[model samples]
Target: MKTKELLFGACLCMFTACNMPEKGMDVDVYEALDYCDAQVQRTLTELKAAEGTIDYSMMPRNIMDSLNTWHCRKATKDEWCSGFWPGVLWYDYEYTGKATIKEEAEKFTEPLKFLSQIPAYDHDLGFLIFCSYGNGYRLTHNPEYKQVILDTADSLATLFRPRVGTILSWPRNIEMFGGHNTIMDNMINLEMLFWAAKNGGNPYLADIAVSHADKTMKYQFRPDYTSYHVAVYDTLTGDFIKGVTHQGYADNTMWARGQAWAIYGYTVVYRETLDPRYLDFVQKVTDVYLERLPEDYVPYWDFDDPNIPNVPRDASAASVTASALLELSTYLPGKKGEEYKNAAIKMLASLSSDKYQCGKSKPAFLLHSTGHLPNNSEIDAAIIYADYYYIEALVRLKNLIENKAVI
Candidate 1:
């Protein structure tokens, strides 16, 4: 683990210029942290300036994609992305210990109280509760936050069907046509269940999480370790219906974010359970991702899409994969760990560069994240989750350098 910090110090001595690192090399840790701090300060100033014009009733939201302008658009608490803005604030508070940021985090968190009471939370409870209240409890040790997370876990557990051995991702009535659908994205939500079960919610919740992962490992992936976006199941018999890609280029194509989710999800599963199979799976899938990624370490919206150089890049996928790789590197032994860490370092460097990092003119930090390309939605735009994961990766890197707990 000390290798990451040592590498940073070594790079400092090798380079004459402090801010500049050779292309594909890791930037100095101090410079990276300064970049994060500057981004946070700029975003906070913008948020405050927009206070009078933006609605606080549904406070935190994404800066909608625009041609030459950016503005926050309100989303309901149940919306999958609603928790990320507050999560960003919490990350800022965690990194800087700034009281104003913590106050703002609480302000945005207040609006999400209703999510815990919603009976049908689908598969996004982790993104909704864990990212916000979960991190809040971790930092503040607040009993109320703990209770909210537990209740949200309980709400999420209702979506699990024993026959399917997985949680339902979307409601059956939703336009997406699967009766008992389970998406690779749902795997990301299992962390909250694991946390709740370990923290006195219910031991069965942990069992549910493990079962879901096991089933996903069996069904959602291709022979090459790439993943399908969706796995439809027979609600009555728990049989597989079809493996499809809803947000990808085509059914056979590998959606960039789906692969990112698999990498992050399995790394998390290994963290929670110390399961060897999960680690093996992560290594295999991450190998494919690293091999397929372009020279800069960012990937196109879909890996299998025939359009190569002209395709839109998904910064969100790169950010998520980098964060996961940082944690995964810690768990690997010797040179393998260093390899993953270095790759992640390269990713952070590329992302921090002007090519992807949003300028002060934009409301968001990371830019060029394709939310759903096939749907003609949010393509090559700034996304909230991208910023959240980028900040999380930077803080996690800082924590590792300081010999602190990462998650």
Candidate 2:
């Protein structure tokens, strides 16, 4: 009887230990502890340096507007680009376990909600709701945050054009129809819908989400495996436009960010559907992306365009690509999956190797981010999203290797 009780206790201990995640694989978490500590120290130093809180709002609105205009400014606060950092910071808090980032993130979230209150529902609401409210719910299990996610998902579903069989990019402005029938980054929103179905028991959201993926595979993807940033279709006639361009070189050029979206987006689709098309899309895109990557393992902002002399490289794009590759690797088969996993691992390694990364004390960030054209204010600054995704990729890799998951 004594021997049996001891044996049972030992087995229980082993089972509990097996369920816990292993340490040391998550380098970003360790690094971020130091980084966020340094940031908190510096921010406190700056606060001390300021004699008083200077009222920037007292300055004329024209000056404030002019200051903002010199950069890649979005027309509205609710557009997708505006939500990127909030999402990234949300990830940062999860990785680092720092309360300061969460506090700063809360400050950022209030303004986003203020903007969303006018409630311009579009393709990007998922970005905001998922990052701000969804993440908040994940961390705090706050019912208010969960409601925010549900309401935002409802807003997003309304943007679905039954004609195009996908969500419209813009809900209020018809002029912003560049993304009319385009199934680009909007695919990422499916996760929000999928969560809705599972959590709120709304299967309609999940059904439409999968249907959108199918429609995207049919229309936006090219034979060469490239994806369109904006696949404009006639809202009235439902006809295809031969070529289109939004932020890239031509309508045909593969914008690196859009490719990142497809790579990650399709992987999410595969997770739910287990549909072969999503898997095929992942394989084809990863193959092309890996082939075209620069010697540093980071890619240019646009994969198809020739390298312009002295043009800035987009580290943010590289970060996004790395993140997507990490996610896509999980769905691949056998040795093929290992290859994809190795490629993502290589990219993350190269990013951390100092050739492409920022030095430790700028305090602004730690990635080589590029934005807009040369004339833009944020043209070559290290962006927060780059840091966010780079850390996310590292954490994801840690999870896969340590968990002994197939990827």
Candidate 3:
């Protein structure tokens, strides 16, 4: 009898050990905030030094790596990534209340005012204008910022084709994407439209956002909820052409960031519209995302990439997912909510570690983000949007801990 009891006890111990959470899974919010603060200060110092050396003739594009050296580039106002830098500064100021950060935010934002007047720009107006001016209006309630946001929303709404029932993402002039290409990334831009309608813009702007989301819902996803990176449509006939994974491994494969965008986008849509369909959609997508995540809670650039364990991970996707999951937790009930919250916590813990978070030596905060891996572009590098969403996630977590309202 004694021998049998000993064996049973040993088996129970093994089961308990197997169920333990990974290291860094239980992150302290205070510590995470401290880490973010230090990183932001380091990034500020790096930017100050860069201002003297890097030419900002056009606008700050991204931190580029050449022969292991990182530098910024000047890009056109229509560049998709133009707003991320200013948006980062605004976020830092929001979190730390640092006047220096606020001053820099205003300085960077000044150049982007012209974007609001250019209606011919593509679907990136939200990433270009809203991330900067939308956050500005949220914090300061500045009337000028509000006007720019309203104008940009109107400009973005112009891209919506009633026949296609979706906003055109890439212009027809871009030969690669054809005339009417819509991408999963465009879902992130809808927040600006939702905000515009809620504030002062036309209600039809919100309708446009809903229509685009509904169309994406109908056409962009596969049977298992993994999404295609791009969907092509005939502009004149409003006919479905084909769905392709332009940045992914193949047409049927899942791009990590594209899936992240779908999950985050639907969560925001549900937040704004309170439509049960959006919530259900978010749950389905989130389930697939959580199940496919690596042991570290980070995901490879492409889920279908044959490389599997050897591929580059996209920390940006993880950051975006973590932020979305935090909001999603609030909307869900009981075990489901706790499960998502825990998953987000695990992702944050992994992202905050030395492997993913950049040190003071680097200009950017988050590292190992894979952007366009198939194109051999920006692979395993620091991306500004990654840092933006990381900080945003941390702030949201902190707010949740403090029982404050989270946006």
Per-candidate TM-scores read: 0.91, 0.78, 0.89
The numbered model that scores best in TM-score is 1
Question: For model 1, how does the per-residue alpha-carbon lDDT over 143-220 read when each residue is reduced to its tens digit?
Answer: 999999999999899999999999999885335655689999998899999999999899999999999999999999
Q: Considering TM-score, where higher is better, how would the candidates rank from best to worst?
A: 1, 3, 2
RMSD of model 2 against the true structure:
6.8
By summed lDDT, which 10 consecutive residues of candidate 1 come out lowest?
15-24
Which segments of candidate 1 are over 4 A away from where they belong? 1-24, 48-54, 59-70, 75-77, 173-175
lDDT by residue (102-187, candidate 3, tens digit) is 87777777678888887647898888888888888788888999999999899899989999999988775447866589999999
Among these predictions, the greatest lDDT belongs to 1
Candidate 2 lDDT, 1-407, residue by residue in tens: 99999999898657634432343222343454355445434433333325754221111111111122112223254445545445555566766777977865565455555433544456877765675666667876877667667767776777777777777776554556643555477877788888878788467888879878877777787788888877776777556654354556567777776777778788888887788877877788768777887776666776766665355566767777777777676666567866776676566666665565544434433445555442353445556556656766766765664564422
User: Residue 30's C-alpha lDDT in candidate 1?
Assistant: 57
